[model samples]
Target chain A: MSAISIQQIVKTFPGKHSVVALDHVDLLVESGELFGIIGPDGAGKTTLFRIIATLLLADEGTATLRGMDVVRDYKKIRKVIGYMPGKFSLYQDLTVEENIQFFATLFLTSLEENYDLIKDIYVQLEPFKDRKAGKLSGGMKQKLALCCALIHRPDVLLLDEPTTGVDPVSRKEFWEMLGRLKTSGMTIVVSTPYMDEAVLCDRIALMQTGKILQTDTPQGIIDSYALQLLAIGGDHLYDTLQLLRHFEGTANCFAFGDKLHLSLKDNSYSAASVTAYLEKNGRTDTTVEPIQPGIEDCFMAYL
Target chain B: MRVLLFLLVKEFQQIFRNPAIIRIIFIMPAVQLLVLPLAADYEVKNVYITVVDNDHSSYSHALVNKLVASDYFVLTGYADSYAQAMLDIEQDRSDLIIEIPGQFERTLVREDKATVSIAANAVNGAKGGIGASYAASLIQDFNTDIRTDWLQLPRYNPYPVIAITGSNWYNLHMRYDLFMVPGILVILLTMVGSFLASINIVYEKEVGTIEQINVSPIRKYQFILGKLIPFWIIGFVVLTIGLVISRVAYGIIPEGSFGLIYLFAAVYLLAFLGIGLLLSTYADTQQQAMFISFFLMMIFILMGGLYTSIDSMPEWAQVIAHLNPVTYFIEVMRMVVMKGSTFADIRSQFFIISGMAVFFNVWAVLNYRKRN
Candidate 1:
């Protein structure tokens, strides 16, 4: 059974200059799968999460979770979905325990009923239970927010950039926790701008400018890049890029970190011939080698 | 219902966890109820006066002496001329100025009526009226005394239609403190409950907590009720404290049924909390909510007959006062406390408050968005 099925979803904000936040976006998540939406800022990842969480209505699409429509069955949908927003949005003035209890009671449950699910996270906050939420550290606040979201034992979890401002160590810990949550057969849909985190997800959708460019396994997307790639770097990186653009057998030349990845227009040019040609042009110490494509390489290729 | 209880508990924890906000929510209301009533009084006393005795005669001196003898006026200093007296008035050193024209006793004996010019500061119209009346009465008494003994004229009471009938109601002693204490209590409750509740919710919206709650399983009505019930109870508790202090310190107590008063108070508190929720739906920041609530509170209290009787206002203002909830609350409170009114007597006010509560709560729920 599909945990979440979104078909041709479209959302637009109205004003003098209307913004089309999402455009014909379609996605499907199998039951008990951890799916990630990988995109930069303003890539409509947050909009899609909000719609699936039943907090917003789409303009021209139908989205269902476990055969329940997001709009018509919002009350029932709210009971089974845990949503952590991009920002830390708990009551700042209330204590950590108080915020948790408030949200627990909001779902007609108690702390004792959900203690097992949140015990690991809540124990870290127990020492500072009496302290105001505003006085907590960033990582501790993130944990508290997660506890509040998961207090009801939700069947599906939707997190919008949960690790945006957290530290590196905390980000690693958060992903480990998500891995543990996946073992319990909870379907999770997470959005992130970090490309490194994309490897942890079972599947990911690479989005850009309100459109999904590709949706596949991390390895699958990397393997699908069809180009003859070569990394060229020397003393003159910018001049090498200009020289490569003018080269007779070059299709596309773009910089990637210390080296530039260049695609060939046709497979006629040899590596030694290109190197000797650069040396004759007073460009020495230049190295040329074929390289395997990664996700970042694939991203640059599409751009 | 269970969610409402949780929200109320959370609100209490939020308020109690911060000492500064606790002081503001609890102690400030007590101070306003106990201390501010004494400080804010309209009854003028010990008004400073400057006298310009231009006549330099016994009659002029005696008139100045009489004016100074009255407890209402204090002779601050003697001015050299009317211009100096006017200067004193402008400088706020004196509230009243007395100028005695050069009229010896012989002139009053011959002319039968001597003129005395008095200038009063009319910026505060009530103080000016009282000062002018007191001065005029003193002069009239002096004229009567002269006519009876020194002039050797017929023993007659000049301006003899002196009919004195005094009446007092609600507050028999007409203590300014009694009149002001309840009004200040009303203002304090309005600030702490309605204004504070609205501002608190708006602050959540500004900081993005409302979005969090929107995504949760909490219904819109449950969330609003949760935010409101806690503040409503706090407002009631604060009002009770104010009442106890008024009774202990000022010896004031309600002569009517306590249950009836609380019923009215509960309805009134619901109206106020509803208003706070409505304001929260319209505002996006704590500062905007506070400013708007303060503005509305000022308008309501001013028209509430807390400071002045609304009946004395113009027809238009009186009509507006009927729409103000504070006005009806103050009226009901005074009636029950001072006149021993019952629920039947205040049923009209009760209906108005209930109507306002229902109307505002429904409007607030409608305006409050689950998605934004």
Candidate 2:
């Protein structure tokens, strides 16, 4: 059985107009794999994480961690699964050492018993052992929260947007820590809105609104793009974009940083033809080239 | 048990780390205890009076002197007309106005009849009601004095007068502090117990820390007890501080056994702390918890019969008072302190409060949901 399996899970928040936070979602994570759920804000990533963590009940269908039902065997699941909420949930008044000790004790284990599992992350936090969790920098707080979550040496870990709101350098280091934890025979399911981070996961599910648009390895997703993609760059990029939108055989065109990524409908479009077309529209200094698509390009394609 | 121990440690660490909480725990009790009983004095004194003496005779002057000497009334000023004295009442300068008629002792000597009208500002009901009765009784004494002086004294006079001598029980000197301090201590204990406990869990919810607790392996009862035990200990600490202050500062020692008061306070804290925790579960934010706790505290303190007698309340109000956990605690506190009542005296109150404690705590624990 997979470490975590969710089948036809549906959750809706009640209101005058009910919001479907999770609409028939299904997921499977193999043991010892780093899986990521990639989506933007309001994409229901936190709601899904909360459901699998057993903090919430799905409106329909069932979810299980290690083949134990989330609703019926919640007590058994709680023992083996560690959840770090999207928000920084540690007590701000507690010292770093105290926070680790508190969560460890709650899981019926001590830091000393599972010190090896969290030693790497806790090492960075040790210098600030006496510092209150609230007074730490954003990076340090995330690291401390990670240490608290991992101190119990659980079989599965669920982190919701752990690296969000951190400096780029700290975010990179946080992913590296998760990479190491992935190899420790623990099923790690994490979520992030940063599309670039999708490449670091073993597999990723691209989510939009409340539905998963596509789920595959980053390379597999890029390889599955059927349209011919071309990058168009020149002066007056906004005007270039508007001009390209009316161009014949143009399937879809959107700005990607400094270049406009243009896909063709069929063999009727070519790079030379696009360049000639732009120059015909009073655009002389223009560059058109076919480049490999990244995870973001695939995500945009899926959108 | 170990999980509860660690939870308590974490709670105490957090409580002591916040400087504001430390200051509140110690300073609030001292300030409220020192100020509340003194300000909430029931015995009204220094009642400002405006006397409109239309009679310029010695009888009117003598009545005014009696009022001045009684220590209860402070003669603000003597007004020339009844309308002038009415201004004093309207301006809140005087609580009562006495209008002496122009009989000038003639009505008393000739026909043994006279009249004096009293107008009191009933805005402050206690001061006005008590002050008016004091003035009327003083005038009655003056009337008897005049009649005695006018009549030929018979050494063995034959009018049978029923004289009733009464002894004040529980409080010989009728010290208001003796009556008020213990009840105020109950309020202090209630504030520390209920208000603090109510806001504790909700604050965690606001800060998102409750999500961590919800996802953990801790049992529901263990979590509830963890939140409760710390405040339960704080309740005793506040009670101890109040008792010490009452004994040293106000010179009030419980006439009954200290064991009985502590026993009652222990159960009382559990009942209301359970209420505070129950409120905590229902509220999503600390502000909501605080407002709901404030509403309940107002009802508990007001209907608890601290300031007014439960016996004097309306039938419906009396029912609410009996239903209130605070009413029983206040009654027991007064009984133990003022009347020196033993366990046997307050046994029914003890059982009722114990029942309330069980009911509130069981309800609170069952209502607190880890998943929701």
Candidate 3:
């Protein structure tokens, strides 16, 4: 059996226009596996996490954690799953140690009982234990929130965009902490908008506009691209993007950093042929070469 | 029970940490209790009077002295004509006018009949009516004095008289602060209990900490109780401070038992705090909570019979006053403090408040949903 299973879940927010937040979303994760939900803002990632956390009821379908139904067995589910929301939800007026102890007492356990589970992250937050949660830096606040959520040592952990605003060094340290937690046999499910973090997960679901475009391992998602790709580098990049969009037999072209990744319908056109064509169009400075695709390249391909 | 204890600890810590809340809780009652009773006095004094003495006899001079001596009236000055006195009334300088008719002493000596015309500016109805009554009673005293002197001459017979005497009950001397202080204490207790409890939960919602609590395993009743007990205790502290101020400042001690007051206050706090928590459940922000609480409190306090007598209100307004929880507590405070009413006297108020506590708390608990 899977650690988490969601079937045909649909949620809509009633308003003047009535936004459909999730549309027939289905997913599954095996035990002890690190799953990632990769999407941009407003892509229903938070909505999905809220449903599994039992804080929301789906309009249509069912979700379960380890075979317990979300709505029917919510009381049981709440005891076994640790959910950290996207917003900083701990009491800001409380000190870091008080915030953690408060949650521990609510869960009917003390910090000394589950010290081993949160030891790795709590050590990083020890220096600021007496400081108010609101007074800490952005990264320290997230770390304290994580420690509060992990104090009970639940089997399933759901983190919603935990690293959205952290500095680069803290973001790296947070992932390493999660990596250690995962090896202890906890089923960790996380979400992020950064494509680079998606590579660290065991499996990822690519989502956009309340729908999942693809779900697979990082290597498998990259290998599924069937078109020949080329990178075009030159001065006047915006002009080059426009020129490549209008070029004959060009199937897709997207700006990726300094280079433009382009795909062609006909494989017969080589890098030398494309460069010769650009030179003929009064473009003096240009270079073209074939290259491999990354996860963002696959996401843009799907879009 | 342990969960409730922890929750209470967190609530007390947060409440004491905020300087603004500390000031509101401890200092506001002292300032308002000291200032409001002094300012809210209803005894009418210093009514400006303009006398038009057309009769320049010794009798007229005596009447002017009598009117000026009464504390209720301040003589603006004597006007030569009634028309000139009317000018003072028009300019808002004088509130009442007494016109002494011509031949005032001659008529009283011969036919024993005299008339003095009094015209008052009735724009301020209370001041005008009370001033006119005061002037009329003083003149009656002077007439009796002259008739007594005539009776001593043995020419005029003294008529048989029947005098009516009355006594003021519950508040002798008719001190207004005695009436106002107890009522103001009720208002202060209600504001502290209901307003603070209403805003407490909504602040958590606005800051998104409610979502964390909702996702936890805490039951709905436990959460609502945790929010309720702290303010419930604070309500008693405010009531105690108010009682002390009334005693030390105005020399007031409750004629009834202290146990009865606390018994009534304990149930009253539950009912009002339940109302506040009910409002918190329906509101998403502290501003929304405050506005809803304000709207209800305006109706509650105004119709609560603190500023005006409930018996004097229109029948429809009387129904609203009876329905207000604040009205019952204010009445209980007055009955216990002023009238020395015992437990048997306030039996109905006690049961009604208990019912309201159950009604509002049940509604609040049912309305506070853990999942949405």
Candidate 4:
């Protein structure tokens, strides 16, 4: 059985006119996979996470974790799942040791009991145990939050945008820590708006506007791209982008770094035809190459 | 129980760690309790009087001396005419005008009858009413003395009569502080209890920490009790400190059972704190909770019978006072402190407050859900 399975879950927020926050969403995470739910803001990602964590009720259909019904087995699920919300929410006035100890004791466990589970992260936090959680740097606060969530040694962890606002170095360290945890055989589900982090997950579900656009392994998602993509590099990248958009067979074209990635309406269009067309249009020193799709390319294709 | 213990430890740490909150909860109430009672006195005193003695007789002068000696009135001046006395009162110079008529001593000795007109500035009605009564009683005492001296004549017969006496119970000197301080302390305690409890949960909700607790295995009642218990203990500590100050500053002590007074206070705090928590649940921000608490606090304190006697209130207002938990505590304080009342004496108040405690706390707990 899947560790977490969801089917046709629907959620709406009441307002002047009701807002459908989640429209017929479905997801499944196997026993021990680092699954990423990739979406921009307002995509049913948070709504889905909240439902699976038993913090909210779906307006329709059902979801379960380890074969326990979410609605009926809420108490049991609360014991098994660790949830870290999007914001830095640990008590600002509390010292780091106190916050971790509080969450540990809340789960009817002690810090000493889970020392092995959180010791690596706590090593960085140990020296500053007396400092208030709010007084810590952004990276330290992020680590402390992760430690508190993990103190109970939960079987499944749900992290909502954990590294949304952190230095690049800290974000790298955070992901490395998650990688270690996954290797130790704990199932984790994380959500982020950054498309680059999709490759870090074992599997990913791309979501937009309350709908799941696609779900697959990161490599599979890139390989499944149906459009013939070409990266054309030359002088004046912006000018090349506008020139490519005016091409008769161009389906979509956008600037990517120093080049413009262009896809055609027909896969039969030759790369030499594109090079000849660019040279005729006063472009110089142009290099054209067929490229395999990245996750962002796949996401843009789906859009 | 273990979960509750840890939550309590966390709560107490947060509460004590903020030096501003500690100062607000600890130092401010004690100082206000010490100083507010003396400043909030409402006893009738120093009634300024202008004597308009038209006759200028020995009897009139004697009555004026008696009024001055009673210490209730200060004779500011003897007006030459009633118009002068009216001007004095209108100008806020005097509160009462005692006008001695022309017949003065002649009518009293010959006809055994006389009349005097006393005009009072009734803008401050309590002072006016009290001052007029004091002057009337003193003049009557002087008349009786004159009759006694007249009876010393050889053939005069002593009249058989009845005299009435009164005793002021609970407060013999009618010290307003003894009555007011306990009531004000109840207001202060209620303000502290409800304000702190109201802000507690909303603060967590605003900071997003409540979402963490919401997803935990902590029971709903455990979470609420964990939040309220810290403030519940603080409320009692505040009361104990207030009571000690009441004793040291005003020489006031509970005349009834000390155990009974504390029992009533505990129940009262429970009711106010529960309402505060209920407000917190309905508010998404601390500012919203503060406004809602302020709105409720206004109604609770005004209808609480702290300053005015409930018995004197309008029929509807008195009916509303029955619903206020603060009213019961204030009444219990007076009954226990001044009247030396026992449990049986305040049995009705006890039952009502116990019912309020159960109603408010159960309502608060029931509305508090672990899920959004």
Task: Give the runs in model 4 whose Cα sits over 4 Å from its true position.
Answer: A230-248, A255-261, A268-292, B46-164
**Model 2 lDDT, residue A85, Cα:** 90
Winning candidate number (TM-score) = 2
The segments of candidate 2 whose C-alpha lies over 4 angstroms from its true place after superposition are none
In order of lDDT, best first, we have: 3, 2, 4, 1
Per-residue lDDT of candidate 1, residues A56-162 (tens digit):
89999999998899999988898899999998999888888878888888788988998988887888899999888989988888888889989999999998998
Question: Candidates ranked by DockQ, best first?
Answer: 2, 3, 1, 4
Q: What is the C-alpha lDDT profile of model 3 across A1-303, one tens digit per residue?
A: 799999999999999999888999999988998999999999999999999999889999889999999999999988888889999999999999999999999899988899999998898899989999999998898899899889888889999999999999999998998899999999999999999999999999998887888899999898998777899888998888888888886889999999999887677777777787778787769788899888888888877
Once superposed on the true structure, which residue ranges of model 1 sit more than 4 Å away at CA? Answer: A92-101, A110-136, A234-255, A263-282, B150-161
Model 1 agreement with the true structure over B274-298: per-residue lDDT tens digits: 8999999888889888889889988
Instruction: Give per-residue CA lDDT, model 4, range B1-372, as digits (tens).
Output: 989988898999998888878887878778788787777777777999998898888988888888898878898899999998999999999999999988788888789989988888999998999888878888889888887788766464566678797878889888988888888888877987789888988999999899889888999988988988898888888888888888988899888988998888888888888888888878989999988888888988789988778899999998899988889889988889999999898999988988987898888888887787
lDDT winner: 3
Between 1 and 4, whose lDDT is larger? 4
Question: Candidate 4 DockQ score?
Answer: 0.70
Candidate 3 local lDDT, residue B296: 89
- Give lDDT per model, in order: 0.85, 0.90, 0.90, 0.88
Screening candidate 4 with a backbone cut-off below 3 angstroms (N, C-alpha, C), the clashing residue pairs are none
Q: Mind giving the per-residue lDDT tens digits that candidate 3 earns over B23-61?
A: 887788888888998898778799899998888999999
Cα lDDT, model 2, residue B127: 88
Please give, for residues A193-267, the per-residue lDDT of candidate 2 as tens digits: 999899999999988878888889888888988888999887899999999999997888899999999988888
